[model samples]
Target: NITTDTLTIAGAGLISTAMSGDTLTISTTATADQNLWATFNADTGTTTANTTTDTLTVSGGTGISTSITGDILTITTPALLNVVEDGTPVLGGNLDVGASSLVKSTNVILSFSSGGEAAVNWTDISTALTGSGPIIRSVGADTNVDLVLDTKGTGDIDVSTNKIVNVVNPTANQDAATKNYVDTTTATTAQGTLADTALQNIVEDGSPQLGAQLDVAGNGLGDGTNLLLDFVEDASAVNHIEIENEATGSGPIIRAVGADTNIDLKLTPKGTGAISVADATNYETNVTADDDIPNKKFCDDTYAPLHDTINAQTGTTYTLVLTDDGKLVTMNNASANTLTIPTDASVAFPIGTRIDVMMIGVGVTTVTGDTGVTGCARLAEQGILIGRR
Candidate 1:
């Protein structure tokens, strides 16, 4: 097998100036200024005389059997092509790779790998293939597999490969809260414009469902599920998000819940700080305490009693301890007895002053008044009791 050896040009990347199964060293040095070019095996160890600034040509190499005339090289044999690294073998006519030919292929399958360590990040390619943006699939008239610019439609020749084209029209009320999707469309729908707005703008554009809120769907749900226009309030404030787990061993599946966010929160009684009872103390919850109130309770101290009683006395007792204050009297005796109020040098009470008396013993207790004193105006008694002027 005649294998083509690549000649390394002085640069940062692996670029070949020429390749052939021969001992060839292609090197370069800095020239002040000029575009540099080279020909492969052009001389064949023997130089040809080109007297003027004219075209030079190279002859056959490896899998190609050719002869150079003027500036063009023509293949003289039906060639067998092979991809030296990892790519589809390209040729002038139809590529014959081993026993297979790309002339009448319905589709071509390709995979990218970088030394089994990383994936080949496709940037530049040979002249045979070209395109860009929004993963596209073009079903041409011939329908033989080809990724050409503007392959899907007569629109802009988008060269970006990482894009999605609307292959079918999305169904109504089927999902995405009824958002238009590129993969669901039946025509050349520019998906980047629709999805670039993000989920929020999409929801904000449409009317929400009856008593429903728009939320990002999380958990195992696909990107499409994020558009599930149904946002349900989980509790008082939490809203769940739907996304995929992307966990190993689980493969790539849509999860129904990712996480949540809180809306608003409220307190119980709607007051700041706390209200608590102090030890062995009560609070005047209705009003603020004043000087007369002092906020002190009976448990701390007590006041003097307001009522008093004197036992039976043998002699007549007329002068009351409180001369001006009103008094009521009740008497009890072993036998018939009376307590009398004598009149002499006694300061008369106010006109409204009245006395009352009662006898529990078997004796009459009458309330008799002196000449200056008025008789009992309102009194209840059983015996002659005394009243003063």
Candidate 2:
């Protein structure tokens, strides 16, 4: 019922409109400086558009792609993309950064743990390295951290065929010394010659011959406190002389040690020089002097009669041995007994040897001589007999 002029189609510069009979027709057409599609910014502000090409393009950014197949639009992401939103990224395989360095901002720690053991942490401490197990650590201050190298079990850090250079001179007794320090401090002369100043550096030498007299000065030839000198034979230590210093006591020992069983320590004086023993203050008991240093027994036997050593005999006939000199012989037989004194050829008795005889039983004692004997005596009871050789 509507007429052509009475019905109108409104188009907002995108389509053309008209009315035909009972049908209202609308068709898209290009307007002045107008296109179907327009390029917009991120803020939804329209920027520019092409009038001839009114295509809406769907492009992709890095690690992404888009494709349109018929009426389907597909967007694809990267295949190796393991990262999730606000989470740690874990790769299925090894992460290889091609030709790039993996940089860290702080100290790196390499942690290790066994079945029942605590975790061992090895940390990089900028200038030095440290371990939580303290197997190897830096000792000293931060600026001058002393590196300590340690081994576990039979493990060894072997620097094969490589020389350790730039080593500082050792200060302590057990410290490691460098070649330069050893060469400079040990010797200044040629091959076999050793300088006098280098004597302090030589700890031990096999068959070391002194070029001059060794002057020990006030320090002497010892460790200053104990063992003064040691003499060894073919790597076997035999004797050592020790000087025992006393704090407040008067007795200090110059001890000579013979480091073996049943060994004699002898001090031989140079020809005809007497061994002078000074300060004979104290008396010693149960001591046997090898030399003829007179003891109490010798003094009593020579000067007194109260301490004569007795040689007791029980048989009827007894022979006087060399040990019977200066000793009393007592015969204790029930009958008469004969004391036979052998000649100097059989029993060589020294000159002026004297022997005393006593009859202890109800018997008579007679002192008889052997084949070439000179002195003889007969006594009814007890008497003294002196023999001369």
Candidate 3:
């Protein structure tokens, strides 16, 4: 049972006490530090009657500090940062160190690691930093390692106008060669002055001229086996001689060809040597044209006749053939007999061909001409003689 004036509160700046008919009430006052003290008292609310007084302590951690004056508590924080040694600190903004260098020890190497991969050390090669600039090269101990410069996606490594010098002489087919190596090797090998002269003579000269005697050692001049060696005129397209080598089981051929249909390939022998064929057995058989050559057997049987051999014709009608030239024909028929003379197109008797005809029987034999036979009036009138003049 407490009256309005029965309850008393000594800390008037922090709290206020009031009584209403048998109940008591304690409340926080409106002050600057009211919220701080209210939270502190609420955290330590368990208290008994006549208990020991509780002390509210405010301490600092790392870069923070706390202080207490007459009735106020002060928490002091540092202006600079002091991070823990073992913790990873993430900065939301840029960390700029003004006018100071970030230094590392000589033995410590800077590396890059990404995507949970092992870190690779930077600048493994030793560089000479004096003179013009640094010469990027391999280190002393790593003699076998190669220095490769790779480009990113479709990018090219351009050297601009500079040349890569001091290259070694190439031994492989695909290796790069230096200008000095090419000049030195060409001068000493077979491709020297003589080859240059030969190539220049062939390409620059208009006439057919040779610097030296042409020698076909093993290979031929034209296209290889079974090809033609054509000798052409400079202006004429149709006039040429094609000398062709035959394939297996055939002889070689030399033919004259031109726009004229009939052309002759004449071989005039030097110094009275006769035009002779080496193969005597395989002679030219089909002798039809005027320029055709007759073999020995055909000349002996057809043209050169035996004077004493007489061809006795017992039939009534007899025709003169090519074999009848330079021979005597005797007609022996009981009835009147007729001896026919053929045209030059059928039998092709040579000029000055003579055939002697005699009437043996009592029948009077008369010589006649075929349809196209001309200049045979004397022979057609008299059957005693038949000649082609």
lDDT tens digits by residue: candidate 3, 37-115: 3463433222222224444567999878888899898888866556655355778898787997444443223222232
Instruction: Name model 3 segments beyond 4 Å from true.
Output: 1-195, 198-227, 233-238, 244-253, 258-264, 284-292, 296-389
lDDT of 3 at 258: 80
Candidate order by lDDT, highest to lowest? 3, 2, 1
Worst ten-residue run, lDDT, model 1?
Answer: 298-307
TM-scores, one per candidate = 0.17, 0.27, 0.32
Candidate number with greatest TM-score: 3
Please give the lDDT score for candidate 3: 0.63
Worst 10 residues of 2 by lDDT: 39-48
lDDT of 2 by residue, 106-197 (tens): 33332222325452333243322465232333433245555557799999888798876668889999988986566557653533323344
Candidate 1: Cα lDDT at 166 = 48
lDDT against the true structure, each candidate: 0.41, 0.62, 0.63
